[model samples]
Target: MFWSAEADTSAVLLAQMPVVLPAAANLYSALREPAAREDEDGTHFLFEAGGQTIRIARLAGVPPEIPLAAFVPLDADGFDRMEGIGRLLRALQGRTIPDDHRLTPQQKRRHRHMLQATDGRMNGATYRDIAGVIFGVDRVASEHWKTSALRDATTALVKDGLAMIAGGYRMLLRHRRRS
Candidate 1:
């Protein structure tokens, strides 16, 4: 689940972008299955278009019926915001949204393992048990449990997964940046 600020990376803020006025204002009218949620900051709309979920947020004062402008900030997340908006625009234009390249194959595998390990731990499974399930029971049995690399990997997965559950999952929406 995403918190308010973290969700900004995924949700398009219509109030921030320069208004496309006149004809463009009717663009939102064609969106289907819009689910609106009212919050202190604004009203958020979730639309399903082109088999993708499009999140749009309008500031508190903006009328719910009127589609507001969306702005991309000049910050670390500028590229991420632009990418998200690009996907939304493509979906709006009846084009296919490309796959997200943020997480590569290895990262995807590790994330999947992390969630699996976390779930196993939550269900009272031991690290050895988790490793067995992930790396195959036969492979896990071939190595000494106390000093095996697979054992350490299983532990790390559970640790990272717990961190994600503690709100670190928000980072998934961001692009990696090196200092």
Candidate 2:
């Protein structure tokens, strides 16, 4: 379900559209590229294309009618791209889109650190505790630890970890073809 921040009508319109579960799944799978970021609610997706950022979210419950002429306000190019996506979904029907991709060595390392940070956070560890575990206690307690590069890095790691679990995990699989 796509909506504008300023309007509730779009949400209402989306809710009324017939539920095409496979299309929704395929749409999400197609959208969840390496760059995509999902909101904490697990419904919204944010990504960039052609240097423009895009966001789309799913509606919760189905409504009665989909209003004709309801349009999602996007730039012309963006609108065209969205139309293309709709066409692709119509063409594929219920067929699934392949989304597997291999994690690079760098990604693997970052993912590991992210998992560690996430685990620590879930276990009630403070940022300092997590930083100590990953970056060394001495380093975390140093004068530079306050407003330091290490602190910033740790915060970024936690945020990335949360984003991954939120929706990025779907795109972490090894792809059949190499880029």
Best by the lDDT measure: 1
Per-residue lDDT for 18-52 in model 1, tens only? 45456454565565534567788786777666667
Residue-wise C-alpha lDDT for candidate 2, range 45-163, written one tens digit per residue: 34444433334443334221332122355632344334434433433354443321245677788899999998898889988889899989987788466778887888889998999
Query: Which runs of model 1 end up more than 4 angstroms from their true locations?
Result: 1-5, 16-26, 64-67, 177-179
Clashing pairs in 1: 14-69, 16-71, 17-70, 17-71
State every prediction's TM-score relative to the real structure.
0.81, 0.40
Model 2: CA > 4 A from native = 1-101, 174-179
Clashes of each: 4, 6
The true-versus-predicted C-alpha distance at residue 167 of model 1, in Å, is 1.7
Report the poorest 10 consecutive residues by lDDT, candidate 2: 6-15
Each model's lDDT comes to 0.76, 0.52
Q: What CA root-mean-square deviation does each model show from the true structure?
A: 2.9, 12.7
